[model samples]
Target: MAEMKTLTAAARSGTGKGAARSVRREGRIPGVIYGGGDAPEPIALDYRELNKLIYAGHFLTTIFELEVDGAKQRVIPRDYQLDPVKDQPLHVDFLRLKAGATLRVDVPVHFINQETCPGIKKGGLLNIVRHSVEMRVPADAIPDAIVADLGKLEINESLHISAVPLPDGCKPTQRDRDFTIASIAPPIAAPEEPGAAAAAAAAGKGGKGAPAAKAAPAAKAAPKPKK
Candidate 1:
C-alpha cells in the first residue's frame, strides 16, 4: 500500500487570478479541496515543500493528510497544472476521501525476475504494453505499484492482468477483458546469407522471382505509316 503523506496548507481568503498571483509571488502554491459533499475549500501550500513531493514522482497516487489551519483532512491529488515555460506548479486540485470511497488511480507497473525468465535468457525482448494500470481502490488500500513477474515467461508469451496478484480491495478499472500487460517477443531476424541474396537477385533477373511480366518486346512499332 502507498504510504500516506503529510502536507501543511493555509486557508485562503482571497480568490481569482490576481489573488493567486499574489500567493505565488510569496512562494506558495494555490490549490483547492472539494468533494465529500462539503463546500470546496481554497488553500495554499509552501512551494518548496510541495515541489519536493511533486518531484518524487508518486504524488498523484499517494494519499495525503492535508493539515489546514490545524485541522487534518484525508485527501488525494485529483489534478494539477504546471507552468508552460518554467515547469513549476501553477495550480492543484485535491479530492476529499470519505469513508468507504473508492478512488480510481493510475498505478505504475514494475517488472521482476528478468534474469531468470526463459525468454530473456533466449534473447527475447520484453515489450511493455501498459506501463501503468488504472485501478479502483478503497482510499485506505491504494497500492504503491502493480508488480508483474516475468520468471516463467517464454518467447512469444504474454503476461496479463489476471496473472498479477492485486492488493486486497484493489481492482483494475478495466473489467471487460483481461488485458495484456507485457510480452516476450522472439529476437529479430538475422541478415540473409550473401549466396541466398545473390541467387534471389539472379532469379528476379530471369523472371522467376519478378513481380511484373516483362513488357512484350515494346510491341514492334507498327510499321510507320507510308509517308
Candidate 2:
C-alpha cells in the first residue's frame, strides 16, 4: 500500500460566497469535513498544496492526513468544484474517516500490453468503455488503479469489471454480473470499383473487330420509274 499524504488545514470562522472569494484572494481554498458522527468543520487549505495533489490525479483514492490546528484528521476527498475558465480548484468537501471502516471509492482502470494484443496486430482498434470502477474497500487499503491485461484478447472480445483482479479486501460495487471495460474490433476498409476498370481496359485493346454480312440492293430502280 502507498503512504498517505499529509496536508495542513486551518479552521475557518467565516462562511458564504463572499468569504470564500476573499479566502481565495489570499491563496487559500475553502473546504468542509463531515461524517463519522462529528460536526462538520469548515476549513481552508493552501492553494499550492491542494494544486499539487489535484495535479497528481490521486485526490479521490489516496488517503489524506489533514492537520487542523495541531490536530490530525483522516479524510478523503468526496466532492470538489473547479473554476470553469481558470481550471483551478474552487471548493472541496472531505469526508472524515475512521480506521478499519469500509469506504467506497472509484478507482482508475489502466489497460496494459496493447502492443502484444493479437487483435491490435491485425488492424483492429481498442475501445475502453469504463475508465474507472467503484469498489468497497477499507480506508487504508484503497488501490491506486485496477489493471486490465489485453494481451490475450482477440477482436470483438472484451474484459468486464468482474474479470479484473481486485486487491485484498476490495470488491466491486457494481450490481450487474458482467460490466464491459474494454474491447477490440476490426477496422473498416474503403470501398473499391470492380467493373469500370475492366471495360476501359477492353476498349483500349483494339477498335476493329469481326464484321457481319451485308443485305441485297434491289430497290434502286423504283426511284427512276416514279420520275
Best by lDDT: 1
Error (Å) of candidate 1 at residue 222 is 50
Per-residue lDDT tens digits for candidate 1, residues 23-110, read 9999999999999999999999999888888989889988999999999999999999999999999899999999999999998899
Cα-based TM-score, every candidate: 0.84, 0.82
Question: Model 2, 120-145: lDDT tens per residue?
Answer: 99988999998998889888888888
Which candidate number maximizes TM-score?
Answer: 1
Model 1 residue 185 CA deviation (Å) reads 0.8
For every candidate in turn, the CA RMSD to the true structure comes to 8.3, 5.6
Clashes of each: 0, 0
Off by over 4 Å in 1: 193-196, 199-227
Which portions of model 2 miss their true places by more than 4 Å? 193-227
Compute the lDDT for candidate 1.
0.93
The 0-to-1 C-alpha lDDT of every candidate, in the order given, reads 0.93, 0.88
